[model samples]
Target: MKEDKRPILVFGATGRQGGAVAEALLKARWPVRAIVRDIAAPKSVALRQAGAELVEGSFADLDTFRAGMDSAHGVFSVLPANLSETEEVRIGCGIADLAAESGVAHLVYSSGASSGDTPTGIARFDAKPRIEAHIRWLPVTATIIRPMIFMDMLINPAFGLSEGRYTFFLRPDQSMQLIAVEDIGKFVAAIFADGIRFSGRTIKIASDTVTGRQLGEIFSEAAGRPVIYSRFADEVLAANSDLGQLAAILDNGPLADHVDLAAMREINPEIISFRAWLATQRHQAFDALIGSDRTSHSA
Candidate 1:
């Protein structure tokens, strides 16, 4: 197979979504240039070893953005959501602006699933749409992807996984969409490969849909012990404003995740279901979480 000579500059290459995109792009034979704050960091070094050309840069530095975008054919843009909303918007829009000025052929921005059409009134949810709008006005050809809740979040110990139960934003009967971190990369690579098909398009992507009850069943089966699933207790949500708003969003707002799973699978057939993903990548974690609390009664 002929190699793709044009390089794609990847931001946040040391982080989850961006790292996945870089790996997927490399697997697809696309040359990848990753911008990192620390060239000697283990993650950055691993990326370099995996064939990414690392360029030291920071989001606060416009010169680094220009240097990375220089001679690049495409860019995978992702920003850490924990940053102040102003900072997030600035860095996100700045990357898009630079990519356009540099004449990059394609730019893909990774936004959140809850962002679109209307504001969710939450800072994190609201920030992406602002970035999305900025990318649209630019002269560059761009694709925006709104990825659903990450499946990996299910295994988090904070979610009561250490107590033989799972607590999340969804009610027992409420179904929500989720995607694996690895699949995010696949979708981005596909978007970069056929920009004509995905350009100017803002699509939501997910691998599977499951209800809170279904999640319990899957967890139980995976751990070989019954695990209960429940929504965050009323007091829990009431106390933490961010958690409360997020739970409310999952209940009735945009975070409900209305992704077309079949079409997403058609685009990338290897997208793993929640059960399959748990079985493969998260089996040991699941085992450990369950094994850690042997005295906890099953729900």
Candidate 2:
């Protein structure tokens, strides 16, 4: 029998969630192998500098993906969210098939919070359910993590946060879960350590729960200026079908189904609160958006 030589192969290792997972795995001294379309990409180079072994590959290439996963102890799988219609399902099935064929012991798939038995009516959010179903039939032991809306997403340029105010899909007073990207890494590393604890289990991971008013307060504190939150204006959504459709789904679906904060704390005791995260991240985040520098004092 050939001795196992490959490390845990993490797909989408250059992106937010997978990158965080790879960093945590390396910090725990677990060998991490990352698949990247371009090893020369700055993010990929950063992963390499952080001690990740890189495999040049794309999601469309099953052969390279199989080689990357061969005899791996586990795999951290996260796909980019750019696919059209149900193509996201196709890519996920392809990865799961290759992992099982390569004899991977465990697979951790990162899915979205919007994925549920009932469709959310949003293509992007609803795409994961099909992929989750596909992973079920594979011979590999798989753990699915349905993560809440990323706190960092609030700052995306398209979200109007960089402008004066903010508009999101959630209604005021409706509680929704949010997780820091770093916490996803912490949570996933825990899963990788004891796949038995997580295998065959689909878990929702979150760091904090907050209402729209709470989002406003945090934004105000982080920006050192008042910021208000409201449902996207009907006219706004009507103009931008993509954003509008997502907003509609959030309004009608279980998008705001609260995650048990107590359970998440049990899994990651060090989960940061929204206020603390804002304070810690404000400077860099502001810099990215406004090209202005601000000083952050240690709390």
Candidate 3:
């Protein structure tokens, strides 16, 4: 089969989500052009080594972004969450506008789980909706993907996994959708490969739904011990208003994953469940954070 040499301009290719998309696109035989702050940076160098064309740039510089879009077939846009909400909105909207102006055939924006039709009352949640609305008005073929909570986040030591307990937003009985970080790339690649199906669509994506109690059970299995799972305590939420707001959103229902898993599987057959992701990433020593007794398993 012949490769599609027309380049897809990918923003933030040195980061997790963009890196996954770059890998997936390369595997699918599509050409990738990555925009990075430093072409000499190790991750950027790796992308170049892996057959991606790299453009050195920062999100703050619109001209650098435009350089990446030159003669591009498509654009994959995702702004890092660390930016101020206002800055995030500006960059996201600017990228969409540029994609339209550059005549890029398709633009896929990686939005957040909390963004939807109504205001989420959280600036971080609200930013993407603003960007999405701007994209809608533009003369561009754009698909908005609102990804669910990342499964990779669950193993972080800050979430209490290192203490043999995991605390999160949902109640033990309340279920939430989760997706592997790699799956986002798989879905994006498929959307790019399909000439028409995904244009002008706003999609919610997730791989599996698991209640908090089920999460406890899964962690117990992985760790070979009873790794307790519970919703963050009332006091914990009270002390951290930002965390509290997120929990409140989940409790109120706007933050829950509503995408159809069956329908999503049709789009990307490679989507893996949370359990599979855990198994595959064990080599990274997430097992240590989750209290997995590797010595016992070896014995």
Model 3 local distance difference test score: 0.85
Candidate 3 residue-wise lDDT at 244 = 85
Q: Mind giving the per-residue lDDT tens digits that candidate 1 earns over 1-299?
A: 25646899998899999999999999998999998999999999999999999989987776677988888989999998688888889889998999999999999999998886777778877899999999989999999998999998888888877677888888898999999999999999888888899989988889899999999988877777778898888998999988988888888778775777789988888999898888777666776777853332233
Q: Lowest-scoring 10 consecutive residues by lDDT in candidate 2?
A: 290-299
Clashes of 2: 0
Instruction: Quantify how close model 2 is to the true structure by its C-alpha RMSD in Å.
Output: 3.2
Of 2 and 3, the candidate ahead on TM-score is 3
Write one digit per residue (lDDT tens) for candidate 2, span 73-124.
8988898888864678888888888888888889899998888888766787
Clashing pairs in 2: none
- Candidate 2 local Cα displacement, residue 276, angstroms: 1.7
Report residue 125 deviation for candidate 3 (angstroms).
1.9
Instruction: Report the C-alpha lDDT of model 3 over 226-282, residue by residue, as the tens digit.
Output: 788899889989998888888877877466647889999999887787777776665
lDDT of 2: 0.80
